[model samples]
Target: MPVYHQPRKRIILLIITALALLLIARLSYLQLVEKKYSRLADANAVFKKIIYPGRGLILDRHNRSILGNDILYDLMVTPSAVRNVDTAYLCRILQIDKTEFNSRIADAVRKNGKVRPSVFAGLLPAAVHSRLQEGMYLLQPGFELVPRPVRSYPYRAAANILGYIGEISPGMLKMERYADYQSGDYIGLAGLEKTYERVLMGQRGIQYIVKDNLNRPQGSLENGAYDTAAIAGKNLQLSLDIELQVLGEQLMHNKTGSIVAIDPATGGVLAMVSGPSFDPNLLTGTERTKNISQLLADSSRPFLNRGIQATYQPGSAMKPLTALAALDEGVITPAFGYPCRGGYFSCGRRIGCLHSDAGHADNLRLAMSHSCNAYFLHLYRLMVDSDKWGGVKKGHARWREYMASFGLGHRLGVDIPGEHPGIVADTAALNREYHGAWNSCSELYVGMGQGKVAVTPMQMANAMCIIANRGYYYTPHFVDHIDHADDTLLRRFREKHVVAHVSDTAYHSVVYGMEDVVAHGTGKGARIDGIAVCGKTGTAQNRGRVNGVVTDLKDHSVFVAFAPRDNPRIAIAVIVENAGTGALFAVPIANLMMEKYLRDSIPLAKRPMVERMMK
Candidate 1:
């Protein structure tokens, strides 16, 4: 159309032609000269085998190995690659029948399609693996022997605490949290294994290996240029003394209960045992499925960590906290005493005392020594019915608040999973349960640690730590620190949590009574010869609703203690189910465990006692 337009159009065409030529040249160079790039075509030539790192170790306080890592073999199969193979010889080498072999092949095809490799058989026996490995060439591209890492328990103790690992489930594969995981990946299933999984599961690596014509792996492809190094997981150092754990397990044999010990200063758990436990190794090898099924069928519930999962009434063992609450509420003084005529009447209900002697309930310290039920019941009444709070409801609410500060009716933030927070009834809940017409006398059983209030053994041991530390405690934990890592992951446990402040005299009064209990009173069975132990014994009611009516079974024996009195090193809780009294089984076992840790040995005279308790 115009002369200026012609010039502009020519210039645009030139620029476009030059750009097209440059792109072509660049492509030619990349195809013909650039050899530095990764050879994607070589992917079929070089197999990318996954190199699994050994999981992190679980170690005791002394750095001794608690769990062992053993390498096991699995037979991986590609159903599509199994063409023209001798089925009889293959099954014979794998020590399986034709039916079982066919079943596995069909299952593999269903799970992973025909091309992808899936485990045909897992945790192979050594004899079977050796035979299959030798005859593997005849089996051709169908099968490969892959090594897998498995756990072993060296101590054969703390089965429920160490836990186990298993294959990733289909449900887990769909979750965004496990997006990186594949179907065959093994994951920690329970206990410490489950809690510290991410840290313990080391990074996976890749290796490139070239195969010969016969289909056997040769050396690394291209001198391992494309390989990545696998990193072994970081080690976790626990606060547990393995010896102490073993002893607790031994003493708890033939019984159904738990023993929990904690270092009072740091809140680190020293030992935790759930009784009737199976050997942890039973869940490790080829027998895992069968052993797990058998363990699941046991009525005693060997898998349950009773220390943190099961709740029970603290019974008379709760009197110390009751005394502290009363003193803090100004309902009772340290010097206050109660009069007892073998028992006391409240709301026309008779509450029995541990002792029926004169002067046993004359002073607060003596009341505690004798576990005088009437004295603590009187205190619970006064605190809840005080005129300062102006009503029963408000006073009880304040009391509940104090218990919360003491770490009751709540989870203590233990590193392990499935901790029970226990039941600590608030006034509103009580009001509804009682139809809004209840008084302080209606729940007096709570004063001596019964009725609706309950606690796990772990909580009871932590409570002992509060009294031992005088007012504050650290959150009880099993792993003290991760070896070679910064303390950032464990900062929360290092914090000091101070319960509501009562006067120092109040703590002193409670401690005095507990000490006297071991010195000459009801809990003399808990006394260690050279160490001064402050302890409280409990005979907790195990009740049930049978056909809508109340029924009481044999009581649970419980004992909570901290030793060496002045600077307590360890605080412990022991419970024996269906035991008659705290003095019968609970107290003696706690004392022996204390001696083992503190004194390092039972004396010649105490050896008989240790043997008797072990039985």
Candidate 2:
């Protein structure tokens, strides 16, 4: 061979040697490192089964499980494996028509594709499950029974607060957060379930099943060697008192409104009831989809959680806050008096007073006790038009700021979803609304808990907490502590939220006045046998468009209160929609709830009152 041919031969040798090494490395990686294709290639010979963990339990203050789980069967389907099966017999066992059966199979195929299994008929009834199980072997390869755990409400209370779970949607599949989740996976849809999903969802496990030629599960693949264990979700403990919750629900039966009770010290919600509530069980098992559809179609909107979602005028329930704002601004003292004869005419529009007597508002304490509309209207005017903050615009702006600090005008960041800020018109908004020419008198209705102001039952209840605690409040919450969860998930709830540095004297006057109201004034209905209940009544007017004109619907009966006066424990707000007056319905319900929570049992004498309210 020539010298040039020798050089070419060496180059060819090096190239061949490098090619051999590359092929060896690729084969080693495929055989030992890459596990993607090591599984049985035939879709019928092996199946990947997802083992879902048991979802978290929700307990009450007493550690009693309020929301747990129940086992139900889902008829899972692998669309491609469907062969010669008795479709009509299977549909009969499942209690579905041929069209419905075909529709479900088509849907499963569309959702998860032909190779994967999806829920054909989920959350089967016991009778259906038994019948289907007996015939399951005949329906081999296509459909199989898979156990699924669903939520159960033992007491059947707190439907809106506990929320519901549903299957993951297609849109969610495209998102990175839901990457691990498959089609038809159950997820929390609302309320506390939605709020703590990450902590409560736990971990899902995978198991490979060995299958015969007929696609029947023979046993665990590889003796379960490749199986992963499912970890159960962490439990959650709420501050709720189930007994109190039961009582509130009973009292609110047939009513469309809300009742929110909180621990004054911790801001932990004891009971939050949104009336026209259905049993939480309705959203689980066989009846879920149909019941949800019915609920959604209901005219009253049973899912509208009024505690934080609905907003209304504060009515006379706002007098105490107005008084506090004025006192804090130094525009009024406890001794400041307002002489009223049925109404306040200073605004030249006549903001009417409930009590017509001239002596009804002789002093701040008397005014608060009587809920004299004229007195509070005057105080609101004094704050916004005081010339202390340069102009009424700035003063009004400052007043709104004070209210926001009091947990008004914005979302309180409650654990639940869909909380409305409740319409605290800003200065710019006011300017746009009133065309840059307005004063405290322009919205005197707000001072009397009417007009441009709107508030949620949760905010009102939290405001009661502020007064009960003398100027500070915790952000109202349901879950007190999550079992096995880190403190990082709950630090915000543990921190204190101080509103203003109002003097103790101001708090004393307001508390004493509210006490007097319960003792011998408009809130007399809220009086308990031994507890010093400080309360205020409200008849909040509701308006809506009728045909074309705006007209008044029935006024909402509202009441806000705290128990024992000194060292208060429970701060509560109740609103009964379309009810005539606050004293007629809201007062009795609030006081009854307080009594039940404090005493744990009602006296025989109060039994009649409970019966009447429960009606």
Candidate 3:
């Protein structure tokens, strides 16, 4: 107790002095030592403008520019700076009413603070921009005309392949991935544009500028010392052949269907055409919103990318896969034969056959050549009921595995978006549908590519690539390469995927049969001179409502083919909805595509067929 009381008073005084000194130091640093806070306080007189880099161009296989940029202008405004301006004259120049102008200004102020610039009118055409620029001086410090880049489709074909871009939405701006984007920034809306958006959208640079008291931008601060240069987006080289794509589109015009062509050696997509398609130009410029409304309201669904989005029963076009599965499982040999008697009368139901001649399907080759429904039905039954699998479920499971390996009954993992994984019923699903009462005959219609089986046109084309390659195929993709880009984006497409380790004997037998189908059977309509075309025809049965009742409608015509029989270059798949037989419409289209791609032009002899199909 000697000196404790006296030391307590000194300790309290020392603590108080330390606190006062700390507060004084902070105040001195803020008010006299630092200038950053002063600059921030005067931020209303500073402008940070964005310098948007031009988007990369899209080129075809032949180095032709399919998509390029065009010069456009955006009318940006700062609400707080808008004074002594003639609102009526500005509205007339922008072709807007006074109410709309006021609303736009209010929106701009809400998005960006009253002091910052926001887009009032965007993507204006050159003609309109020129007219606006002539009178922009009257608007002065409040408004500025800034150059913006917009996509222009020179070819006007492949609208579904080359998608459009639109301004970023409020929701998108909130997403973590799009944090770098501003409210008025453009984004890819669909097709290739959407798929390769990161590669196509260039980086934006920011430049902080000094401004006068009136909010007019002077030169950059510190001679652009803090500015970061924008990097232009990498250009993409597509595997598509614009000529072939145009031809496919022309052939499919006025029809409801799709055509997909793939390069056998590389799995590169050469052409993809979905019918009822609109010109790509329709989705560009100032008319985009109105055209989109009309497209959405149309019943034909021009927005649907049928090649990758539409799935339907593949019919006998799937016969080769069924045969390969059976042969791979050792359930059938190359000489496996099933004589047709007008129908497959096994399992109590009469599944009809395409032909009833005694020797039509006496062997696998003749069976495939004739597209004999009885033969494939028997093969499917045998594969799913074989002693090797022990039960129907096990055999069906094994068969489904084989189909999946061939990229059937699933999404082929194409580069494009909106790809649907086509349906393939598993044992569990079959159990659910038939209450565990299913058998080989319970779903025998699947043997002939019917009954719950579906495939996208892209998958159909890739399957043909598998057959053409004899063992393996790369994933079907549109972009062949990206300029000034890393290989990380293309590593997946470069990997070869094997369907199975089936023997050369099995593939040879199937290829021979496919060739015979075109040379001596139902696929004769697809035969090309000097080029051995291997093809299969299919008529997929479908149902529709008629007068408030479900009824049988015209079958969908389908065809799959590959040319040269040895060094195949092209594989094609065609589907025409509500058409007669595959040989009637689909086969001719396939033949024309193959000839055009392989021989560089359709021969004079095939011109009649082309004209007929165009009708």
Candidate 4:
């Protein structure tokens, strides 16, 4: 403050001079030493570039052909960088209305700003692109065409199994893991597509290109030295026999059930057909919306995947497991007997055997061959009635354990999704159901494979496999392996579950009883010459009563069988709903499948019992 205020003007002049000198030095450095950075910064103000990757491909197990891929394309847009564009003419050429064209232009402008560029049209067909190639000057300077890839499926029959692919929605893109994806990126939606998405979706590659002021790609920035090459997706090889699947589907045309065939030794699914299947092509592209709506509207539920999802009362097909359980538990000796006089039993009025009259007692083998309901009722009571077995078993607890051992009370853990763990009622469950009024009568129906017990056809098939394997079975699976360029990738399912908790001697006896079934009993229809076919037949009544009387509503015909009793190969279960008599309906179908597997031919006259039962 001494004379300081008067020196303010001099200080200000000194500051201006220093600033000017600093500015001159900065300009010299930018124009010389940092010229490249300055040039790039200036170039970025006028031009922009985007990188795109080619989508991966999917192939069959053999790596024969492409199942999905991308074709090169020229995507174009309109922006303020261009001087003039005939909006009306361009809209007409691009099959859009003037209003839509204007709206799109406005959106592009907002996205890229008045000085930048954006994309407006994508995936122009080669012919259309050729037409526009000669008229580039007529379009706006900011318009650009970017190459892209789309997903597709071949061999459309495996629609349900292979599933469909679709564009990712905004919500999907917002997910943290999908941050790199845009709204229109394709993703697996179902089936194997959903299952193997990670392996099938290869890493994306990119290329950086330089652009001119007009926003047209001028050339590669570094000759693509930093570019990564797109890798193709791995191929998959399924255990399914396409021919067998096709035949099964054809045979089941117009029906509403599922057919699954597995190799007993390997548990490889040979054929799986859910009736009313639709072509996979229907779910691709523009026609997808309309086709999916039609399929959904159809009452048959073509998309239900019934082969693994639907569970039904396995009916008499469950008897083999029950018999094995009884024998294994030592509750019933091979000498145990029951009589089948006519069509009723000696049990109380409320609970009578399927057969009537009280004839002489028959051995266990004879009872099984005849499917005598009374024999099983006696066995069921022996296992559950603690009073009868001298408290060796608690009420229903031991029986429940035995049944669970047979894999009846739970899911078989097959490879497919949506499998149901069928119903198996115990004392606690019965308490809730009957409110503490549960009795031996409830056990009677269960022994006969009815009332409170439900199972899936897959479970029935697995039971047959267990019996065929002499009390052990591998979990069933549909996929066998995936094929890649360098190696053959394999996925073998091999987990043996022991369903029988009995001695070897008891198991042998039970096997003998099952053999006797086809040798002389209701399952004789399943017999095949030169291939000791052994099986059991059951006809379970549906829910239809008359005046407090129970009559057959529509029988669920079921049969479980295996061939060459000494060295079993294929084991099978067949259920024909609404068909009366397992001997008439399911047995013949089982025999047909066996014949197809063994002799590779359908024996028209082999099943004489079917004809006899029909009469």
Candidate 5:
């Protein structure tokens, strides 16, 4: 019988031994080497809590806090742990009706199963939180108070620039870009907050605490060996001068336009004001949803950052680029001039000029100072019809390249978002619009910034910077430097950008003309006593439809200027929509901004003018 025994029996025994060894190894791994399964098993007796770090502070150039942190508390509830709770007493403590309380409980249970925690009431004030905390034990082991840092604006002037934070949306929670965020996390919604969200939103930490069988937290597991400490956000030091910002906002009150000022040296935004802007605080705390809804519903669109979002025809503000183009191409010179009668007549159309019949705009200085429409129109035609390029299409393409280099007809790559690249009509576009029969003369309106070219106040201000810096500019930005941040975030703005390949002499000639503008030309209203202000006034033609019929409207007042011609500190662009003229409206606002910034005070003599403009 021993000799006849089959080898199959021995093989089966070996296989059974191997299976037992594998099972023991796996069990050993589950209990010791790998902790995931054990953690799952212990979940009933362990609580994982999220620790939110403090957001960075936003300070102005003067070291004054524009936005600071405030302590806020949230009431968290564990649905499954709730028992023997007084419904009416809890509702009274939270200041919610019975129906609302029930609805919240239902929502919590629906969102995060019965065993998990959910927000019962969030962003509670210090007073309300203290009162509720004193009576928290009355609600049993279900509710706990969690503290968080909330945004608080002390100045409250830069609503559009500082931006606001809001709770993460369902869409945001699922996106890979916002993977770090949970359903209850708050994120920057707009403006600077949105731009520097990563820097402002610090890393969140987690703590694992031991709990009893009854689902009550006892102490930290293993003395907090698995706990992660929260890292604080990096603080931002902005280039904005709060005093100047307040002044600009005040000057723009009751108006329907925008003002953008920048430090040409560093491309730092000094003051940016968009009229009809609501308070930044309105978008903070618990009332954000309701406030945002109302703001969105409003017709004026206060949330619109007109400085970068709104595009205008640019009027004579664009003429400086035209002059630069002609000078750079050698089609015209600082010495070139054009004679004008009442208006310019070409291609069977008459384009009116404010500087018509004034004198021979014999040089770029006179042409730009007077904002001679005929002069620029002639220069534009010469630029696009030059024999060097052989055809208007080729010449216009060259012109578009120059505009792109000037940061026009495209986004300036500002730090914030929602910027629109203004329309710069291309050759194909021109052909499509004109049935392939267009020439330089056919698009003469483009010369005066009226046809297809558009610009934002931010672009206009940067263009002025190009002139101020003499053929080069730094990409405009608001933050001068960020504390504890690497240069990668600000390196692009620090790099110099050149435009049109124009000579320094050409830029100097343009500067001389702008100076004359403030001294004796259309921009006389922007003159400061001791400071040499260089400026260009523009009146953009506007049209709108009223009652389903197209109608002509008042011109948009536009002005671009910089002070102290030698070493320019500030460059500004002002656009007053539908106002009479740049000198009448935009000039004064610019003057006040420059004066306040330069001297730290508006002269007593300028008080009356300020009052009149305020009225």
Candidate 6:
């Protein structure tokens, strides 16, 4: 019995020795080879902290405030880490009932895993933050109060232009491109916010801190040497003039159209006011949901940016472009005259003009000044009738190219989003629309900026800029620059684009005719003394008929003008829907805008028309 016991004991001793050696080797490997990993794990247990850099400010052209930062707190919670705390206490501190507290906790857990903190409430006001900061120690172990900057629009306007920020949806979070963004991060949703997100959203930073088992922060591991500091977003300098913008907004109070004014030399947008605009502040804070609902429910669509979004028949505002095209194409000369046979003209068809029965004849200058329909109709026939016009085809294809050169029929590449490219009918499109045949009658309305041609007020303003520039124009821009550390944020759209079909001479001729328009022609109402204001008036007919006949519908009054014929400064486009005639409704408005821009103020009595319209 003693001999057998000795053998078994030796075997058991050897096995125990082998086990000890293996354990020692594993410990040595962990301590030496994986030293960094073990050290990080140890550090994470003692300290955990995060850094948030505030968003940058957005200023006006003069460095005046448009959008600024407001300090707010975001309450976050880790569902699994919350223990022994009364839900009632938490609810009381949060100013919510038990139901809301439970719902919020459940939502947090559902939206994100319990391993990390999820946002429970966001954009809490300073007053609310003050109340919560006192009771923060009573919160859950893994809870956090992150100080963040929320966007604040100080001007309370440019809602469509300044845009708003919203939380990134789960779908966006799922995409690898947005992996850096957490579940509660805010992102730009529209307008300039959406357009220049990269420049506006600064890089996020991280910090390593040690925490105890109770999840309370202990201290920094290496005195913040391992931390990355967030680079603040660049400050944007917009070209908008606060005073001018406010004035324009006031003038458009009761109207339903748009007015866009641009510095012709630099293509900087001075004022872009669309009727039915909303307050930008409404889209920023706690009132967002209610305000959005109100805006959506309103019949007037106050949120729509009519300056860049709404497209309408440009009416006679398009005449200058058309005239330039005709002159450039060599289809018509300045001296070429077309007779207005009373109030109608039949080119083997029954197409009639508004002044046909009045019986007048006009050259290019007189025709444009008077806005004579017969003259343009005659020009349209010659343009489309390539067979009769000596093989010089000035049909839809040529006309479309010329119009495209003026930045029509396409997006103008403006800094703002949601710009309409507008509708332009080519031969194929017209044939498709007419279901097989396109006639000269189809071309008649287009020459007068009716039918298939439509444009946004912004585009119309851009066209006027091109005309004012005498052959070329810089693309309109709202932002002039962005201030950044590495000079990486300064962005300017300074590219010049030439109006293709028209030459400098052609532009000059058109400009001369427009000048005459204000001096002695239909646009005389827009005349500003000592300013050399050149303008064109449009009275576009609507689609609806009054009686059995298509009565001349209440027209959309339009005016496009610039000052100081030799060297233009400000170019503007104004449109008033169902406002009779351009001379009556739009010209006076243009004059007021001109006087305001040039003289820095308008005479009260001279603004009678504007006051009447306001009433």
Model 3 reaches what TM-score against the true structure? 0.94
The order of the candidates by lDDT, greatest first, is 3, 2, 1, 5, 6, 4
TM-score of each: 0.91, 0.93, 0.94, 0.77, 0.93, 0.88
Per-residue lDDT over 99-212 for candidate 6, one digit per residue giving the tens place of the 0 to 100 score: 888788889878865545678878777777787778776775756788777888777777777888888898999999788888777888888888778778887777777667
TM-score for candidate 5, please give it: 0.93
lDDT of 2 by residue, 1-615 (tens): 777799889999999999999999999998999866665354557788988899999999999999998999888999888999899889777767988988988898788778788998888899999998888778876888989989999999999899999988899888999898888789999998998898888899889888887677889988999899999999999999988998899999989999999998998999999988999999998888899999999999999999999998989998898899999999999999988999888877776777897778898999988889889988888998887788888888877887888888899988899999998777898888889888777776777788878999999999999999999998888999999878887789888988878889998999999999999988998888878999999999989899999998999999999998988999999999999789999998998899888888878888889899888
Best by TM-score: 3
Q: Where is model 5 more than 4 Å wrong at Cα? A: 1-40, 356-360
RMSD of each: 5.2, 3.5, 4.0, 6.3, 3.2, 4.0
Computed on alpha carbons, the lDDT of every model, listed in order, comes to: 0.88, 0.89, 0.89, 0.66, 0.87, 0.77
Residue 177 CA displacement from its true place in model 5, Å: 2.5
Please list the residue runs of candidate 4 whose C-alpha ends up more than 4 Å from where it truly belongs after superposition.
Answer: 6-156, 176-182, 343-347, 350-361, 387-394, 484-492, 516-520, 544-553, 564-567, 583-585, 601-615
The segments of candidate 6 whose C-alpha lies over 4 angstroms from its true place after superposition are 1-48, 84-86, 93-95, 140-144, 348-361, 387-394, 485-492, 544-554, 607-610, 613-615
lDDT score for residue 147 of model 4:
63
Ranking by TM-score: 3, 5, 2, 1, 6, 4
> Candidate 3, after superposition: displacement of residue 197 in Å?
1.3
Over 1-615, each residue of candidate 5 has an lDDT whose tens digit, in order, gives 575566877889999999999999999988889997676566667777889999988899999999999888888887877888776778887788989987888989897766677888999877788888888878778888888889988777899898889888888888899987886788898889999999999999999888787777899999999999999899999999998998888887788789999999888999988887878888878787889999999998898989999989988888888888888999977888677775778657887777556574767787787788888888889999999998999999999888888888888888888888888899999999999998888877778788888889999999999888888888888887889989899899899776657998888888898899999999999999888999999988788899999998998999999988988999999998888789888999999999999999999999998887787
Distance from true location, Cα of 492 in model 4, Å? 8.4
Model 3 C-alpha lDDT per residue in residues 1-615, reported as the tens digit of each score: 668788998899999999999999999999999987776656776687888888999999999999999878888898888998877778887789989998999999889878788999887877888888888878876888888888888888999999899999999999999988888889998988999999999999788888887777788888999888877788999999998998898888889999999998998999999998898888878888999999999999999999999998999999998898888888889988876887888878787877877888888999999888988988999999999778999999988898899897777778889999999889989999999998888887888899878999999999999999998999999999999988898889999998788778889989999999999988998888788999999999878899999999999999999988999999999999999899889998998898888878888987888788777
Model 5 RMSD in angstroms: 3.2
